[model samples]
Target: MAKKNSNDNGKTFTTQQGLNSYIKGICDIMRRSNCAGALQYVPELSWLLFLKILDDTEQREAEEAEAVGDSFADSIPEPYRWRDWANPQGNRRLNLQMGQMGQFLPFVNEEVIPYLKSLKNKPQATPRQKIISEVISSVERVRIDTETNLLDILDKIHEIDYIDPTHIFPISQVYEGLLLKMGEKNNDGGQFFTPREVIRAMVKAITPQVGETIYDPCCGTGGFLAQSYEYIRDFLADDITPEQLKTIKLKTFYGREKENLIYPIALANLVLHGIDYPHLWHGNTLNREVIYGDLFQDAPPQFDIILTNPPFGGKEHRTVQAQFAYKTSATQVLFLQHVIDSLKPGGRCGIVLDEGVLFRTNENAFVQSKRKLLNDCNLWCIVSLPAGTFVAAGGGVKANILFFTKGKPTEKIWYYDLSDVKVTKRKPLMMNHFQEFLELLPNREDSERSWTVTREEIEAKNFDLKAVNLNTKVDEDKSTAKELLDFIEEKGKEVALTLSVLRKWER
Candidate 1:
């Protein structure tokens, strides 16, 4: 049999029009059931929802064929061939067919089960299975359009098979990773997914060396590791010998967990992306067994590069044992210590942390740690991200990335004033501004948005890492109400003029 051309058949999956309708129907069903949360965690819901739509479409085709005496049902694909299985009359056959899809769903269910149970790391199957079953059946009730919409969504989703070994990856990769973003932000759900551009910028700056060990103690959806792998391979063209290729393509490059509900997603993501090394684990990094007291003993096999976006401001502190060799008030502080300790003396570390760690007055231990970072290590740079970068979760909390080396103090620390960069999905307010900062970054001296500062300057202000201390160049950049309103008015007129031009151009 000849392979089908999607454009010619106008039936094969991958068409954009098909995708939009499919996404619309899924979003609609999820919204109608008021179980959007299920879409967030319940893997069964995604699978059965997929099956229900597939089966419903298949049945419609079978009915149409039978009416016309064509009987083309037997020619359907493996997934779409669920007509005999969705039969309410043939329960045994239905169970047998669903069993195959059930295998994949079970794996996804494991990822979200931990969140539902409130048990970190451990699997809670019985109740999670019951919940998944109910959610799946409910989602299954939401009908997909048989005539046109079904073909569209299936084509879109099938473009990158979730299971194909040859393909690069899928949006399910984004979905699972977003949960980690949600967990990192401590949002209502997935409100703080690092913009893809932000992830790209972080990966570019970190410059993950191929075959070099890397870990994100708070590896949300393995974004740092995933992008790091791609960036290094793409830009550097690091050779992967046949043997290394096998290992690189199938091993875990970093570890990650999100209340256990997203671990499978993380693992699945890694597998889908051709990473098989730092096999992601399930457990809270701050918990006693994992992060507290001698993390070397807890988290074996130290890494070369530790890059992550750890959880933001929260009261998750506990009087942990000799877990940390250093001291700090917040868990973020403790994580910094753990990340430092996890590295070899020459290892590099990059992490996103709330601004408080940079300048907390009462935290003497944190202050001492900052001193240690300045005097004993290469405290290279600090880049302040815009406030709206994390607008959904840590909206108001200012954040900066602390990039440093583990060994000895390198002369001057660089500071980049990126506080003005607006973070949004559209044109002007995007995370891509970080790349401009990267381009302007100096090897040893100062450049735009990049300036060198020393411990003496930092100590002058009681050791504050905020942009106000080091880079006084932009001191006069504040906007008054009148200036802001005038700028807004000018922008409005520009938009109206542009719209008029567009209308004329279209005509």
Candidate 2:
């Protein structure tokens, strides 16, 4: 029997009762002959969870609309109504398994497509239908319904408050766990599991507002985009009038990606957070596609606020057809250029970057190009996170967050140092450094935690964007005394106990 717990508000936990089982299921399904790492597998789960939640929401909304004599069901449009997509005409996957169909058709012409097209309002349906059909079937087979028998298993998920945009991580933790497990299976999979606290701190510093266009070129597990929306929701929820609320609700929101599996999850994450379906689009930000159109051939939309932690530390090199405004490798440099190109004249951006991009002199011209870009962009802030901050997932690599605004030469930039420290945590991956860091951010001149450096200072080092220049506090004396005394006390106690045991044995 499934374990059940009731909330104070009368909501009951059913589906996510056993957290371990859910984790095991995610691992088992992801390792199922994918010919890929956990990154690929967890995305499969992300997409599946998206569809089931949408179906469950549609079913509930339809019933509610009928009872209230409201046409919300007609107006709202069902983005993932299962029967509409899976049970459509001549589109049956009789003997075929999910992998075959997903590889073939993707998101187009599924049951959900028809329901969306039939919506009384919203033109996003027809274009949405044209997207590949595989995304739908891939999501369909992984459905957490009667077949998987994980319904009661996911009930505990409701307790998580994913719907409350303020509670971003609970929802994010659901995916983070899957990504971490995926990372364990494959060396490259760890990139997706950005700690929620780290993500929250990044979003806080970026200060995303209502109605801003947001983008993540490498949107692993959709953490940044989802958290950005929640940040905006919370921002607007404070000290705003009813009319302001309406405007904020209808404001344009967006996300772009090349990952086919992550695309659906990104959309679902946004929709669940209250953004309309039309806001999210799927396409390679780097490559031209029939659906997303050619970003290279045509000018991409200018985003007002960009928040992302781009994919990092991989050996694969990507080719570029044309010379870029910036110079660097495919993953980091390409994304940096993409984010720069995607921003409006006055946009702001925050991104997670590996230290290699900061101090590499091999690409001198590339380094010069980045300096020019940073100066032209008015780079604002850099926060260096500690090493053990992400130690559990391997890749003890150091990382930092870069914040900048578009279209102005930067005179000076503020840097905060929190690296090389241990955050108080009962478990691994729960870092509280962000909270401590944010407390000192408002001043921007805390001698112990932050420092402001001029462009000349940065240029002196040949434009390395690292954060080590910031002021820091270290306690070496305290560490020495604690280590020595703790060792002596432990050894002394052991010797005394051994002597007592020997005396007893002799008697």
Residue ranges of candidate 2 with Cα displaced over 4 Å: 1-11, 14-48, 63-176, 238-251, 272-278, 289-300, 314-323, 392-394, 423-431, 469-474, 477-507
Clashes of 2: 27
Judged by lDDT, which candidate is best? 2
Question: In candidate 1, what residue range of length 10 has the lowest lDDT sum?
Answer: 2-11
TM-score of decoy 1 = 0.65
Predicted candidate 2, C-alpha RMSD = 12.1
Query: Would you list the C-alpha lDDT of every candidate in the order shown?
Result: 0.52, 0.55
Q: What TM-score should be assigned to candidate 2?
A: 0.68
Cα deviation of 64, candidate 2, in Å: 5.7
